[model samples]
Target: MSKRIWKYAFSSALVLITLSGCIEEKNLRPFILPELVNTPNYLVESFPGDSVLLIAAEGGILTRYADDRQYAFTVSNYPVLDQIDPTDVEVLYSGANETFWLRSDSLIITFSRERISNYRDTTAFYRPTRFYFDYCLSDDGVLHRIDYYNEIWDPQSGSFLSDYFLAIHRFEPSGSGLWESVETELSVRSDLLSSPNAVFKGDELLILTNPSYHVSSFRSGEVVAEEIPRESTFDQVVDPVWNTDDVIYGLPSEPAFFSPFDAIIELPLVAENSQRLRLESACSPSADVIGPVKVLKWTDQEAVVYVQYFTNQLTTANEVVGYIYTYGLKDGSCDINSVQSDPILLPFSNAIRDVALLNTELYIGTESGLLVYDFATLTMVPYLKNLFDEETR
Candidate 1:
């Protein structure tokens, strides 16, 4: 009860606090988002009502779908390239409105025009790459692929480059704006690889290869020139949807690629040969390989992401659960728990070939029919049901 006793008690408390700091606690962080409009448990809102016209992909039309027995709406608005056999045609996605791209099976054209939704302007054009053109994002969408254009300043070689730029491939709304080459047939496979959810950060376009992290650049399609270790900390780069540019490529000072997994990859309007800057990442994945995450629409405020969780319920026979999270580049914070549950359960996640977000509305293009959900109501309605019976969704 004297001074000596008081001193000893204070010392003991300090030691106890220090020891407690050394013990790691289990992480129980719940789903968080930036003012999520709907609960994560199910569809919360932002869906078309039943009275609204339904869209289906029964015959590969994106905007318009065949009704019970016949095609409905003004015209079929699906992606025509998706219907064409890839072996017979070459498809290239430009970074613009919902991945506007170009397609042609004829070498006589030898060029790609912007094609997506109702955006058809044969006059304006961009290069293409190996990309899946849904209504979301693309990796390295705005990245330019420089070939000749000899007048431009030489980068590594320091010469006025003479080769023609094969194509300037852009990924998201404002993604990496890097450089690629369509000079060779293997260029797409050799450079960008695959993975709809892949991300591009700095000079690294982290992609999902067969069994490795295929790291390239949206800038110079070449590696960083360092001895890229055969091994990478990332297991796989996947779910490579691209964000959209607010006003297409003509807009100045936009991002090249904004990915949930990779963050910002390339800065807009940078010199093609600019030294690669060591950009930072906050949501670096830790899995040996993580991919096929859900990609939402592109917004300047923040990027949204979702990871997959499998279930065994009859409804989830081969189900996939999507965990929604938002990453804010402007504020450098992530709302990992924007949902009631981290992984929102879905019975047949893979049943749908792809997903696109129109506002808060979630559209799933599946084998059977296109499913639209009203998040506010937590209700989902199947479109083109009878059509699915006749053909695939």
Candidate 2:
């Protein structure tokens, strides 16, 4: 009741609280946290069996290991001027024993996993035109870029001053880790090819001219265009997948329309008996499919397709989902109604950016984090966990 007695009791409670805090700090364990700069837009196997690399949309790069922890690039590791921004990378491509970043303002930066700090700038030699639309690294270590130029009509002049063109520029890796400009070929006029997608197979360049369903093949300084005969009346075919020149598979759709994944068609490129096969009837009837379809794995006898579908429409909120299906094929003769297997629907609803298969696991790069689907276990696991919270951890 006295002041001296109250003061003594308060001092004793303060000492007990300090001792408990010390004990709590000593018993705490280290928590694993994500070091990602931003959403992982692209995923690649940076090192064989050791780590996977995640690239953000704005040039942030993180290396994720099997234990779920990540390693991010420090300021001293990459040049400040050429440093990858964690908020703004456009394209991250890994091929031909190196990785490339198509940065802002037509800057092409390439680095290897072995020597990441020793990066080389490829755009210094090519310089800038109006802009670049797409790029790829060919089999022979040559970089191919689709360059575009806009033609502006001068009101004061009688004629158009600047002409428009879409061309492919080639760059080879010269000695001392430098890229040298080699050749440039005119693909087509700016308005000639609609939704043109270019890819390389060995020494030949294949450009898909959509709506027409024609593939323009360029080789040895010569160009040849051939049509993929259609089985049904369709407006356009997108996402062409083919390993060999003998056959190609694509989804037929009406251009500029957000529709369901109705059917996928196969076109043979043989000299004789070349025809298209529509496999609409083989798909599952109950699958509520939407969004664009992508063929992930393709072989002579089978193809693995990923379809984005809509779900949870009956509820207050709507969600988009994904389904994976396998389609079988016959060598000599094939039937359109007997190829599809049952679909495997994914559990999560995040928008997928990219997907890659390694051994029995499927690595899916989503807008939020990385996910892995194991075929052997038939289970999906979130590879990267969310940022650490002190209270939860």
- Please report the candidate that would top lDDT against the real structure: 2
Best by TM-score: 2
The lDDT of each candidate is 0.33, 0.46
TM-score of each: 0.38, 0.53
Worst 10 residues of 2 by lDDT: 334-343
- Residue 353, model 2: Cα distance from true site in angstroms: 5.5
lDDT of 1 by residue, 72-147 (tens): 2111443342344322322233333223233333121111122233222132233333232211123433422222
- What would the per-residue lDDT of candidate 2 be over residues 1-393, giving only the tens digit for each residue? 699998999999999998878643347666544444334444333322233444443234555444444555533355443355433344344445545444544345544442343334444432334333445556654566554433344477664343334445565545654343323333333334344444565665544442222325443444454544434343333444455645656565431213445555555544222234433445443345563355555566765555554443331222224555556644323222111211232334434555555445666665555666666665555554323432365
Q: List runs of model 2 lying over 4 Å from the truth.
A: 1-34, 37-59, 63-95, 98-107, 114-134, 147-166, 172-192, 210-242, 249-280, 310-321, 329-355, 366-368, 384-393
